[model samples]
Target: MLNYIWSAIVLLSVVCSIFLGKGENLSAAIVDSGAQTVQLLLTLAGVITLWSGIMKIAEESGLTAIFAKIFSPLLRPLFPNLDKESDAFGSITMNITANLLGLGNTATPLGLKAMHELNELNGSSDTASDEMIVFVVMNTASLQLLPTMLGSLRQTYGSNAPFEILVPVWLSSACALSVALMIAVGLNKRKRRL
Candidate 1:
């Protein structure tokens, strides 16, 4: 569906450019944008590789375990029914850790693993459990301590202070996470009453 939409957009652009007698300009813009996109991808790839390696080191050195321990207190209430020693909970912690460091690509697999484990704990039911719903909400409202991807993009585009968005990111993520949790909890209670 997205591919079809993009193809239609490109087709329209070409038709419009021909009618406007700007075909050469359109061609030049397309070539320039393609080159720019490749350059941006390379830059982002390097940043992601560097951060992924750092996260691997942190994991091997037990840094992630320490982080999980620290975060457990805060995450406990959100997933009250989950056992601390369960694989689902552990995966959830690791996923959150990856997101906090702004390693979203790395976090993806962990999030999926967490969800799978959560589903197993739910007895592989068709319906999502409260914990599962809350976990999804939490992941969506990911709180990043370092917005590495955004910073990389900013730097790639020539920003002097790429990480200057830290405070605003924190404020927004905190508000989002807070509100999402409240809503998830409220809905769960309401559903139970029905």
Candidate 2:
């Protein structure tokens, strides 16, 4: 569906450019945009790689274990079904930790691992469990403490103060996470009652 939508958008853009007598300009822009996209990807890849290494080191050094311990109290109630020592819980902790440090690219694999672990715990059920829905909501509206990815992008684009958006990022993410959790929990409770 998304592929079709993108194809339609590209087709529309090409048609508009031809009608507006800007085909050459559009072609030039497309080439330039591709180069820019590659440059941006390389820059982000460097940042993400650095952070991923740090996260791995943290894991090896038992820092992530400490993080899991710290987060356990807060997460326990939210994920009551997940055992504290389970692989799913560990992946969730790592994913949440990566997100808090603004390592979104780094968190992707962790989130996937967590979801897979959750699915296994769910008896390989076709329907998503309450815990799975809550976990998804948490990830979707993850609160970032550092916004490192955004900062890296801003820096790459020549921003003088890349981290200046910290307060707004915190406020917005916190609000989103809060609302998402509330809705997910409410729905889960409603499902339980039914």
- lDDT score, candidate 1, position 191: 95
Candidate 1 C-alpha lDDT tens digits along 44-102? 78877887787768768877677778888998988889987777887888889888877
Query: Could you tell me every candidate's TM-score relative to the true structure?
Result: 0.88, 0.96
Best by lDDT: 2
Clashes of each: 0, 0
Q: What is the model-wide C-alpha lDDT for candidate 1?
A: 0.88
Q: 123 in model 1: Cα distance from truth in Å?
A: 2.6
Scored against the true structure, residue 148 in model 1 reaches a CA lDDT of 80
Q: How high is the CA lDDT of each candidate model?
A: 0.88, 0.92
Give the C-alpha miss distance for residue 108 in model 2, angstroms.
Answer: 0.6
